[model samples]
Target: MTESPRPSEGRSGGAQPAADLARIVVFAAFTAVLGTFPGIYLAGAAVPIVLQNTGPLLAGSLLGARRGAASVLLLLVLVALGLPLLSGGRGGIAPFFGPSGGFLVGWIASALVVGLIVSAARRPTLAVLLPANLAGIAVDYLFGVPFMAQAIGDLRAAGVASLGYLPGDLAKIVLVSLVAAAVHRAFPNSLPRRKAAAKA
Candidate 1:
């Protein structure tokens, strides 16, 4: 029986592992910056909503699945540890289990989903980009709305409350996708290079 050769033997070489780790760190820091940026604020809800999804979207597009998820989870851990890494300087484990809990969880899941889509697409033009952002938005809404309803004890009110932020969220999705595409063009190898090399 023949055994397949290891990746380093066939590809870039022994340095690939270190290179990959460096990319992971860079992406994680990028997400941290986006998460910490205090964007538009939605007050008086379960927790104030901010245009922080840009971090998840950009991470997924540029970092791909595993690493993108890691970036978001890293931010989550920081927030949970009371680092005030979230938008408007909100943090702590309570937010994770509070009204904003689902949205927080959604960040990880949505990053994964976006990464899966963007990675599979190989080359993300504007045509293919919006859908990926929408997927993350849907995930955010899927988890967030229910939690809001539960927390506020009124589904209608929660739905209405969420509407206030819809425009801002949509705007963030567009901005993030454009920036991600630009970064992808610039970095080219920021994401896992498997799919891209295959296409090339």
Candidate 2:
């Protein structure tokens, strides 16, 4: 007779989906909560500096690519649905077309890049996470700058204006790297299993 699956195996398998769902939901809510802190608008730039940007960084580091993107998407969906889930109590389709819109959309790609890099690492150390998170921010800027330029009709000006975000973004990189590294060290299993395997 064929052997039946072990009880422990069954339990772990059954619980994994639920655990993933819970994590996704929680991260979505966490991102929304970050928006509660008001955004700071620069002297002349339309895009504001906001802590909500860090949400994608942290989610990606902790959840890996697919789940990380899912978490960001969840929050965006709420914002799209007219929920006041964005900084400055802004939400709905309007934000998606505003100057900050590209950056908001970039959050998904940012999470994907960060999670992919982190997942490739054997261990999520600060060394690995710092660059990974920085790459994620670069991806955000790639999408954002062009869109902002389009909106304002000045590519050079948009690029220069985006420089204002550097100091805040750098601080976020350090904070996310430290926090992600600690969490990975304390809970190794938190890393997604499928992508954790390093290719030869």
Candidate 3:
């Protein structure tokens, strides 16, 4: 079996890994910054609605699958270490074991899926980008619901509880689609090189 080339083995190879690493760190920090903004915590909701997910979306759209997922994983690791990186400065092992744990696990997969879509398409416009982002959102719920169900002890009820997040997630999809598409179009070089075509 052939191994994939290392980042250092590619064109402009020496700096490729560093570049990818930088992008990953930057986006992880971006998500952390988003979390610093206020969140809406519903009385019955297990997790607060925050802008943190948007960071993963942008990282995926611009950085491709691997780096995008890495960015999420990085942020999660920090949270696990009790860095207080989450929205409202909330983070720690406690959150992971709480109702929000599943969603936390979902972030990595969500970013991978979103980046794969953009990479597969070769050209991502708002029309296509929004749906891809929506799919990522769905991926998040898939991971979240089961964990929530386990915590709540009612599978059906967990699904019902997650509904409150739909509206906010939908808004994020729209906002991310616009911003990602614009970034691809206006400053294509800013995005990771695998996907997201440069504006002609």
Whole-structure CA lDDT of model 1: 0.73
Off by more than 4 A, model 1: 1-17, 41-49, 195-200
Please list the residue runs of candidate 2 whose C-alpha ends up more than 4 Å from where it truly belongs after superposition.
1-15, 38-49, 194-200
Once fitted onto the true fold, the runs of candidate 3 whose alpha carbons sit more than 4 angstroms away are 1-15, 40-48, 194-200
Candidate closest to the true structure, highest TM-score: 3
Candidate numbers, best TM-score first, in rank order: 3, 2, 1
Candidate 1 vs 3: which has more lDDT: 3
In candidate 2 the C-alpha lDDT for residue 100 amounts to: 64
Candidate 2 whole-model C-alpha lDDT, 0 to 1: 0.84
Instruction: Tell me each candidate's TM-score.
Output: 0.80, 0.84, 0.85
Better of 2 and 3 by lDDT: 2
* Local distance difference test scores for all models: 0.73, 0.84, 0.80
Candidate 2 collision pairs: none
Clashes of 1: 0
Winner by TM-score between candidate 3 and candidate 2: 3
Q: After aligning candidate 2 to the native by TM-score, how far in Å is the CA of 115 from where it should be? A: 0.2
